[model samples]
Target: MDITEFEDLIDRLGEDLSLWPEDRRSSAEELLGHSADARALLESAHALRNALATPPVRAPAGLADRIVAAAKRRADPAEPHAEGETAGN
Candidate 1:
């Protein structure tokens, strides 16, 4: 399949593999040609997928408070911006 076709279902790949139901997987195996190049690509994608499943990097000290303070600063500039203000109104 082309990159565009694969992109549509790419994110669901790992989840779908768990529920492949055997028949669909068998068909995929056959269609993929089971060639060396395809096998290599599969291995690379598997490793990349595993890496993506890892937890996000932890923030450094005081980062959370800094973010909250920054958000407040942004909101402060919009003072008196009440519900009825209606933005452009």
Candidate 2:
């Protein structure tokens, strides 16, 4: 698989296992026949996908900080801040 395949799989990730076809699974199994690392990576991705569907017991508080940072970067600085005229204007 290439970047497009990975990107597509990521897009339809939630409950869309069809991205990984059964035939391809057999191929993967064959490819990883003796490679533990490959098998572990595949298992890890599967577990992560499964875990994504579960609701968090506690909401992440850092989201507000992240949103603020994103907004600051995206926000126009209140009419470009006139020279010597404070934002209070």
The TM-scores, one per candidate, come to: 0.42, 0.37
lDDT of each: 0.57, 0.57
User: What would the per-residue lDDT of candidate 2 be over residues 1-89, giving only the tens digit for each residue?
Assistant: 43334444444553234556787545554655766765555566778878986987885889888677556644655445535645454
Candidate 1 at residue 84, lDDT?
52
Candidate 1 positional error at 15, Å: 8.0
Best by TM-score: 1
Candidate 1 has an lDDT of 0.57
Per-residue error for 65 in candidate 2, Å, reads: 18
Deviating ranges (above 4 Å) for candidate 1: 1-12, 15-18, 31-33, 64-89
Q: Report RMSD for candidate 1.
A: 10.1
Q: Residue 64, candidate 1: how far off, in angstroms?
A: 6.0
